[model samples]
Target chain A: MRRENTRIFEKETTGSFMNKEFIAINALLTVEQAILYLRENVRDKRNIYYVYIINEHDRLIGALSIRELLSKDSNRLVSEVKVSKIIFFKTDIDQEEAVKVFRDTDLVSIPVVNENGKLIGVVHVEDILDVMQQEATEDFHRMAPVSQKLDGGLIESTIGALYRKRIVWLIILVFINVFSGAGIAHFQDVIEANIALVFFLPLLVDSGGNAGSQSSTLVIRAMATGDIHLKDWFRMFTKEVVLSMAMGFTMALAVSAVGLMRGGVTIAIVVSITMVCIVVVGSLVGMSLPFIFRRLKLDPATASAPLITSICDITGVLIYFGIANKLLNL
Target chain B: MRRENTRIFEKETTGSFMNKEFIAINALLTVEQAILYLRENVRDKRNIYYVYIINEHDRLIGALSIRELLSKDSNRLVSEVKVSKIIFFKTDIDQEEAVKVFRDTDLVSIPVVNENGKLIGVVHVEDILDVMQQEATEDFHRMAPVSQKLDGGLIESTIGALYRKRIVWLIILVFINVFSGAGIAHFQDVIEANIALVFFLPLLVDSGGNAGSQSSTLVIRAMATGDIHLKDWFRMFTKEVVLSMAMGFTMALAVSAVGLMRGGVTIAIVVSITMVCIVVVGSLVGMSLPFIFRRLKLDPATASAPLITSICDITGVLIYFGIANKLLNL
Candidate 1:
């Protein structure tokens, strides 16, 4: 299955799926002659949406749709019948980029060219549809809760295989959580003095984790859709900062009443302030980590939910207790 | 944009994007006559890959490719040339289902018919590709960490609008974490007696949250890709139970060593047992949630990562304390 994963990856080149049987006619041929040639020579005839017009050097100069060919004068040369404004992909380009081209162009078929600008193969729209589906599946898999390994197909994976895939992330999270433990250990005296502080631990930390996850997922998704580029990082970060502030203010107001009921005024103040700080910091960290990854040329999706949570777990504990220690004077 | 969303939704009907300019001819028409009619009447000549043969009642009976029409004897009737086994969709059917049909059959254009089997429209392959991209985007948005409101497009949304979308989930989570607080409160006496127990609280609960998140995501993705169905619930649950047991046992062994160093053998035993139980229960709960949502006709994706984490948090705390109280004589 692992080898199969490699095979799939290798097979993603544009040349691998390109249709070699595509109609390529000499530009000098008449529309009548081109149609006659297509009628005689178009084998592997499924999804033949367009005919490529090639010059004397066999370089693709233009493309003619069946409609355009049929609508034109029968004696017109293929170059006269063809549309010169066409998009083409090199054979070595990734299939994902090819799918993007198909989507952006809204064309039914695109020609695949070699380095010399000669038409080598054609990628049909149906192939692009398959590529789109595969890309979506990969994104979903990559963004999984703990991000299991990409061992061939996801759903059909064996139990042991799936366990092996998921446990790696969990183990990393567990180790990262040791820092969370250390933070708790450092604040033990305060916790011993005010045991009620322990009651709000999960609330404060999990909220931060949730907040961070929301911000990171938004950034990652925006990146995935090409809506947010590296150039937009500053704007994205600024937006997150403002959004988190508004969110934090709202949350502080909402949770302060509960905090008051749980403890005294000092505890309420401690918790409220900690909540605001955690929310703001969580969102900023979430928004920033992806940009850092992108800067390093790593996948931004690698900054996953659990990864964000583990990070926030450690920082969230530090913030809560640091605030409590000062405000409660424990 | 809200109106645009509605328009897109309304446009998902099979008839919405269907091309009415499809070439349909009587079976008695010769290939020459069919081609002549197509040249004269086929207004949308861009993607004319197939020609349909219909009976006198306008019921679609067969289909022929352009290659077949061009290569065949010009004197032959359309019926003699067309393939009889054709797949078609009803006009009112959702476009998602039509996309599925395109994927499964790998057909370029599918005819949309009325209830009486009369051809009404033809759905082009290009439209299906567009639908696939849109559907993928919608799924990603729906399964977001804290799903934003469908105000318009997701990434293009305003900061305030995105904050409004996200805060609902956080506020609800805060309320839910209050249950977690109550769980911790219920076990306050035990925690005060054994402060070591407090150190392991995040570790145990977060492990469960992580495990639960993994299960729910896998199930949700499987459901999205059409790999899992309602009937597979029993099998899916059984698989999860076995997988979680393997996962739990492995995690228990690894963490028990750390537990022994933190506490004593009794505390270690308690934490280890609780870890195993929580892992199993967490995974089972996560696996069950999406199925339950699906059974209720709600989106299975609504059982989101944070929602699963919150659910596991309360239950995980209870389980850890429940086990610790009995074993450590708290």
Candidate 2:
């Protein structure tokens, strides 16, 4: 709201926020003349943090701040002082990715280059901040088990729009959850013989779901921030396997205490062993699904909590029942 | 990584990122003297976007940029060209809040003020970007059913650390899920009489959990972004009631079709009616818990997916079996 006057930054395209009237002096211009040119020609100079240097082709050669330029000898050519170490984004780069570059490089402003590497515009750090916030809000929305349309800011959406966005997912999840019912049905005899087995149904499957949800959410967020890559699949998988096993072991020990009280030794052994297996399976499924989605060129966040939970439901049921049948002699 | 040499910015304290070396000129200093002072004293001027103007008492009065000073007449007093419209943060402000201010105001750098409104330092946008990314990662970690320590950057955390962080949540959730088992246990006679009724347990309860997860995730994210404040509770609650009812009706219709094929007309009627009630209950519970947490001065993100799912599972089972008992005259 403080930036009401800076509505240009809110535009979807980066070009709208570009300062076309920027001071891009020829590399040969002396610092004093470059200062004179900036004073005489540049208007709307609210965010002129740096002065760009270009060659005959108007391709960006280097950049220097006004402070840097003023600190140096006014008699020297700008080419003599400008730092050639530059980080820039292409004109067509996503604004979110542009913000990442700025954050990674810690630049006050980044030059925009065309396909020919000709300098066209500059993206100020302030503008990139806005884009980053918007992208973050969108990512949160996408990661929820709701429609993509709700990815827009909640305050900006109408009630009708919110309903429309959320209903589709609930409907799809309802249909998908049918498999969970069928999975339970296939193991009906096991439950019919030992009704106590039914009591652990939500507990067993939910453990898997919870473990899976944790993995997918972490993996998705790390992937988004470029903290993890597709190439790190081996490391990621290995780490998840070891971590989940430890996690599963801890959870099994905790829950087996409860199982010992309620269902005796046979039930305790079945539930404890199943806990370890389900958690490992859940974590592996959750952790790997995002990588698979990325490899398939899909948005990794589409592997949401509910989707992961629903998938875990089937696998969890099969594993829990299979172990119970073998151990409990169902 | 570009800011590796600028190790201070990565600090948890905003004061660390403050540029105490900033050009704070007196109101009467001529633009020439201001520029000369900057040239003589400043070092490591990588992000000197603004020049703070202070009084004799060293209290900040206004700000002027180097570009503004250079473009002005050399003899003009700094105060004559400086703008008093300034935005700033306090030294003790949360880093996430500082990032929000940067995004909202679109400032290249924000001054850090002391208790007496004296400018102590400046927070460059680049530093704010790092804080923002960390906060985003933390939010993702909190929303999951994992431990907070795992919120640390994926690449930086050890496997043992990740396991420790995540195991706490999974173990707690397993204990919480025991109530879902109890809820199912209470309805054992109804299930034994009708084996088909047992089939929809995962479907019915998971639908509730999924719907609840969606609502909680959206509310938590909106709260984090400052889009939905605690003051907006009445409006948020009213909107959620309508939206969830709509979602519930849609899900009920979809699932009842499956129920009819699997369990005949009575089961269809019971499951369909239960679907609507469970969804509405789940959504309302999920939507309001975050508000309640905020009102209690707690982190709204404490209403995590696994926590909500465990809560919903108990209620979802009661609703489904309660409806079946009454409708089927069991």
Candidate 3:
């Protein structure tokens, strides 16, 4: 078996191997060779459709259908009946590009080739679909701000299997939160003096998280769709910064109104001002973090919405309190 | 012009109209005709070397080529000369299923038919790609725990535009925070009685938000990939609950260690128990919200990660303070 494997690999490399394994008999092969292969080696030909044909260089040349073979003289050259022109992928192409090619071709299987144009492997459409599903799952996980791995299972099993995958990031975040917590703790005196300021803490943190999620989602989606690229990072950040400001200003107005309705004018103004600043910071962080991750050659999805929000939670609180202390003298 | 427009609309209803919007001379006329009138048009044509032939009833009967059209007798009947045995898509099929069909067929385009065998639309590979991107983006956003609009601009004229999108959600959260703030403010006496409790508040909230973000990201991702369906909601809930318990218990131990180093046994126990319960609740809420949104026929991606964390933030604080008030007797 080892010797045979070596022989097969050698044959494949030299591009002279003329066996069923090297031939791709089920997709665009010559009619004569396909029939000969079927009669001699293929025990089950019920589902087979087309036989693939390759050249001396291992480049795909054409295809021959089973029906075509049955209609032709058995002795006829396979080349005479084979349909020319085949769709395939170059090996170095991006996976997403491969998916697009598959979608465009609508082929059940496409041949993949190396840089030298030698056929290396076949990428089945089924596999592309699998990749698509996996990618979609990853994007979802990234949005959740969870540490991503391929295997997605039940929470119980996955927690065990993906403990490090999930917790490593969370622990990092936890440590980061310590700084945020410390910042808040450092402002304990302010809280003690103006206890009402503590009333808006959740509101400020929540708002910043929400804003961050929105900006990050748009950026991530844009990147995934080819609607935006890493080169567009600065553009995206600029856009989010403006959009967040307008949104923040409007939100501040609304919060101020709510604050006035609930508390006095002082509380309303403090809450409103803090909200605008927190949101602006959140949007900036959310918009830029994905780009930063991308720049670091990381998956942009890694800077997930939830993770961004968590980060914003720390910053939002710090900003809100800092602004409140300066503005309200708390 | 009005008369022509009326004629066009009438012709469309009767399936007698051929769209003259663009003349693709290289395309198989029959396929092009189907796309011209169909709501969904074929987006690519690089697969299946030859385009299949169809009859007026839209029944697949043969295949033809650009070469044949250019070389064969122009007067030859397309039906008489076209190669037969065409592949296609059954209408009413799932879009994702259609993607699978396209992948398998290796055709540039597939004809879509309804139950009555009438061609309704064409699902182009490009459209599938768009759907894949959109679906992935939505998942990315949902994992973030905040909802975002489906349509938004990626470019910004000024920082204000960027700020506005983020600020809206932040402000909404700020108002929501009022309730949390009120909760914290209402419990001021608790903080005043035990100042150290205030020190742990930020840590507790941050931990809870982090845990919830982690779980929500996983559940949202699983659902996005069609791995976990609505039918699996119970399983998902059960899994999350158990996982959260374990996570909560582990976190309690860790926090307890910190508490012991900082304070005494009473503070350690209080903080530890509060951390465990809050983290567990946060995970449950975070994991469940996306599923709820999906059930409501809303995009689960709209359940942004930040939103979940914010919700967790408020809930985490509530749980912490509520438990602390009861246990510490402030």
Candidate 4:
């Protein structure tokens, strides 16, 4: 249900990932009978871990791992040999959820059931491994916003594909950078009045962006790994705010000396305050954007470092100049 | 061997990850005898897929899946049922290599052997899944330079730990930004004459960092997944140059219009040339830092997004000012 809203996951449900070949034995067969039946039928099925059991209507009944089945009394009925609690997936569960399931149960494969509880197919750990890698890589790309996956390795990918993959985001970021330019432009008077203010521009702004990048990275990965949920946003935000304040003070203490050496006490004050405010604002935006994207049913990694940095650059400019404009009293 | 150089991986070799409990049947047993042995001993053992076959010396000789074993004739010797070639790991192989081996072989668990080929223990698919997630997350943190992972997620991590994790990088970045400050300080006269240059500074510098971030992320993730290697460096660098030039032109085209609107034809030319040059420099630096780190027996992921951006920002400042100073003749 949670995955239905995300477009990338819609098609890869457990129904689509079933192993075509699996042994589904009847519930009536004794261990001895099933072994005899399977010896004739189960030739060369690649790594069969679990053999499913079915009742008269062919509905799912129980399950037995080959390991358990082998270590049982041959005269015991399939009912006596099978596992009591079957862990299974409905046809609609996404591969990500399937990966989570396999992790919990330690079963290499699980049965997938249809609407009427009939076993349609089995999903294996091999597929789960692939999904784990795919989901992680997809999220990696989005966080990097490498934007699209290069199906092959980087060396194997065509130059055009590389160019196309990277250019759009760079261009979009240039557009976003316009606001930073505009923020600087709006404070032309303050900038001209104290040209020394210009010295700390990149230093201060880049710190904000860097802090924001860290915040977004933390929140995005936490969400991706299911370590934190959507309901945890407010708690996360509060933690980020407190975390950023302590970080801002540390950065301010380090940056103030540079500000003082460049432009004296007033300039140091402006840069330090701007540093604190920008770090807080930048970090808050960085941490919050991913949560917003997830709520919109989008990949939270869409709040990439470049995207976060570009945005923080805008806020960084405004905060720096806004602080400078007031303090300089021009 | 690829892992011995990196300190983080040295402790996590397959020797450290071997499962404590596994079934190792002797090569001399008949199928019926082994079954009777297992039936008594294997109750409640979780997800036993492969019962490895060993020789008189306890050396790994072959492996038999329980599924395959059951389908054999009861009177057949274990030699008749066990696979001819076994898939296993040396006790010293790293977990990442273990992960790759599991991916290539469909077995849920692979046995580990000592230098003498004596059976030590088995490694399971469950652990592979954990490593897959952990490796991806570690590289993700390194790329994000989240610096260190918050083991219990963001909400549970202390403000002090969060501050400590994020602050060092931000402080180091502040020092790196000094080059940008010095570059601007060196060009103070040029700015006094043509102050419009300051408006384009954040926008232009960020584009370089953004482009660099993309390039580094590509190389880093590609390396993590084994899609590319250290040997591909020269070829990748050449491709990056070509890729950067094309991207530079595209960005130059986009940024020049704003350049023209703001500061006339002369400023536009300076901005365009600087844009092209900065992207190329940023792209080259980002592409190579990882390779350099790898060669030094460190994590290539140490070439992080924030690190790339800070270095790019420094180069961005110098290049943009050098071009503007020559062209403006101030």
Residue-level lDDT tens digits of model 2 in B1-330? 123224443456676666554677888899889888877765565677678999888789999777777778889898888889888777677787787787777578878777788777788877788888877777777767667655457867899788777888888888888988888778888888788888888888988887888888889988988888988888888888888888888888898888999999999988889988999999988888899999999999899777888899999989988888787765
Q: What lDDT score goes with residue A314 in model 2? A: 87
lDDT per residue for candidate 4 within A254-288, as digits (tens), equals: 98999899999999999999999999998999999
Candidate ranking under TM-score, highest first, comes to: 4, 2, 1, 3
State TM-scores per candidate.
Answer: 0.92, 0.93, 0.73, 0.94
Clashes of each: 0, 0, 55, 0
lDDT of 4 by residue, B1-330 (tens): 223223232467887766756788998999988877766767777758777888899888998887677767889999778897877888779888888888777889988777788787778899898888888778777666677766666678888888878787788889988878998999999998888899899989988888888888888878877888889999999999999999999999999999899888988899999999999999999999989998998888888788888899988998999988898994
Better of 2 and 3 by DockQ: 2
Clash pairs detected, candidate 4: none
Give the 10-residue window scoring lowest on summed lDDT in candidate 4 chain A: A1-10
Which has the higher lDDT value, candidate number 1 or candidate number 3? 1
* lDDT score, candidate 2, position B92: 71
Compare the candidates by TM-score and give the number of the best one: 4
Each candidate's lDDT (Cα)? Answer: 0.81, 0.82, 0.61, 0.84
lDDT of 3 at A37: 68
TM-score of model number 4:
0.94
* Model 4: CA > 4 A from native: A1-10, B1-10
For candidate 3, lDDT tens digit of each residue in A1-330? 133333333211211221123235433344455665654543332223345666666556676543344446555566666667677565445666676676655454566554566555555544565567666665565544556465546544654765556666656665666666677777877767767776677677777777776777777777766667778877676666666667777878877876786668887888888878888898888888888888899877766655776688788778877877887784
> Candidate 2 lDDT, tens digit per residue, A146-229?
776465678668878888777787878777788888877888888788777888888999999899989999899989988899
